[model samples]
Target chain A: MNDRTTVSPSARTTIRRLPELANHDRAMLYSIVDEAYVCHIAFAANQDTHCIPTAHWRKDDYLYIHGSNGSRLIKALSAGAQASVAVTLLDGLVLAKSAFSHSMNYRSTVVYGQFEVVQDSAEKLAALDVFMDKIAAGRNHEARPGNSKEINATSVLRISLAEAAVKVSDSLPSDKDEDLDLAVWTGILPLKTTRGMPIHAESGEHIAVPDYVKNWAD
Target chain B: MNDRTTVSPSARTTIRRLPELANHDRAMLYSIVDEAYVCHIAFAANQDTHCIPTAHWRKDDYLYIHGSNGSRLIKALSAGAQASVAVTLLDGLVLAKSAFSHSMNYRSTVVYGQFEVVQDSAEKLAALDVFMDKIAAGRNHEARPGNSKEINATSVLRISLAEAAVKVSDSLPSDKDEDLDLAVWTGILPLKTTRGMPIHAESGEHIAVPDYVKNWAD
Candidate 1:
């Protein structure tokens, strides 16, 4: 049997159960990770645990998680040498008249794997390039390269998509007949989270928006 | 020790971990559920697994989950009679030079509990009201009530916050002695997710904009 997991809550909205919901395949993996700007990563560290939501970009079957050497997520994975990463995207809200009838539609993923630090000089350079391209599409070559000082302090953790799942729920509310006439209003109030136009960093003085930056997805 | 359940992909972002990471205390539970608008629920049914994301709201001690009578979540929980739920909020992105050194700052919670259909008619009504006020901040009284027909078609499930854990991480990248001077753009691209303006939902045309609606929270 597949080692299936469950996400239960005091509310049913948090517990999604669609058959088409769990996407463990490769194609679905890339699509889910590429569309969003932010992802909430849940990882196990020490005897304790933590979930860190941060900016991320995917390259093939590997997801790159970054942090200062001081950050908990990085420290946990680097020290314990094993981790679980999860990312979710919220699309919109689904409303139903009965208080118990409201819900939302969204896309989410959770990955389990042992992360390995990138150390090879050329491989490290490639990993950095992929990260830039994944986040900004083509910004890697267009933007200035990181100086030696900046590269030394940064750390990147790579989680191979060895075991994972993609789950999505997209349906309007289904209210009942008797409760229909109750005074509460019901309908979807959709929510979309996206990045705004590139606001050149203050340090980007005089540098025109690179074509790579302009071409990045929303 | 609290019961430890596995959170699989079938339920979306729901994950299972040790007791330390899966706490269900008062202060720990309220903040995680309160601060989030959506959640990832994991469950199992027909001997398979799944997880999905949906909107949610909370009551005093119990959380209210609404869905179509045919929802996969309700179907599974009502069957196996239990599940897991998780919500995570992404705060920012930490970009570092090395691919493995990147990370993020965020807060998240995982709750494991048995799911029961809210059978009490009176309590279901109250739960719906709380949901309305929670979202629109007083729109419940202003909006029209639901007819009986609406309530009958939807299913509401209730689960206790008997077990859960909350984790939050925030930190910046380190400009190591060598990588610090790489000239590449370095630093965090801060991120925040919040509710936007009141759409003055078409149904609310008669109500006009109430002060509560005008001053909503993030």
Candidate 2:
């Protein structure tokens, strides 16, 4: 099922000339999403499209995203439906003489499908657990479970793996022969995003950070 | 033009509250876009949608984004068609006890509308100037004008400001009263993306860095 046709069977996708990477590169796709602690979610709403930048986690072939009940995204897809989600990481910058040739090094993935709220009490509980573990494994069991009100007020969405693909670009741009001597500085500005020290809340609070929190990345 | 309407606007779309960032707070939108140099461009194609991460620069109300003439995006939105473009900057990470509460701080702008390639030679030249100025202020004048082939091969899209908004979140997760004693870290992990030194390429030749390059960022 994880074939090029299964994901983007359209002529619109142009991954043919790009070597070292393919549209169906599962490892690359997973790595980009896994390395990122957040994803940008976009969808069409009111004939106008809306893009929401949100934190998300992936488990197996599905994505588990949630937010407070008041969030528009929660309400949009929670009412028995689905939408689209995308995650990406900028690897580096591509500088060239021609402004039009400037590009970026990055790995990105897009998943399109329907998403619905986790309904069955057990499944919903499991989904919630998966999300918790996905973020910080053992921490799921260490922290206080959401009170009934908190559970009821928040919404969790489960979007099964739909059509998706990974696109990666890591090339330093190529400049024309004559234009190459323009004397302009034109090289990459490498970029990396990583999680920093986990600061404790200011308020008087006390709890041990589970080992899972220490190992969690991506 | 930007107002809230609660209705299933289209079959593929349902209104969602994505931070309500566009509600009269328009200047915040421009500032966020200006600070970000890269954006993830997404669109609905085939049976599923796709998101392509690329570099982008803005001028006034319009954003000029381009790629290889063979790019999937260039093919999809050629000559006066609409598309969705988004730029985001991840500022920090939000750590909370509950895995579900884990989040990030970011500023992102999502814009939707039509785009048309600068088909006219004069228009393409103007866009090329804008492109250079956006990256290196006054370098476009010093560089040679793009010929027909160079101009013809690349696709330059002009996105209107009709539908767009900036959604931001910088809050530390709400540390609960009881969970306060849990002792787990619950604060932010700051992030910063900066421009690095530029790399210039010549015919196995090294040319002195021009004032244009030296003062590029100055």
True contacts kept of 2: 0.32
DockQ of each: 0.10, 0.32
Candidate 1 interface CA RMSD, Å: 6.5
Model 1, total clashes: 90
> Can you write out model 1's per-residue Cα lDDT over B172-196, one digit (the tens) per residue?
6654565554544444555565554
User: How far out, in Å, is residue A80 in model 1?
Assistant: 21
lDDT of 1 by residue, A148-195 (tens): 655665667787664666677676666777766655545555565543
| Per-candidate local distance difference test | 0.58, 0.63
The prediction achieving the highest DockQ against the true structure is 2
lDDT of 2 at B195: 45
- CAPRI-wise, candidate 1 is incorrect
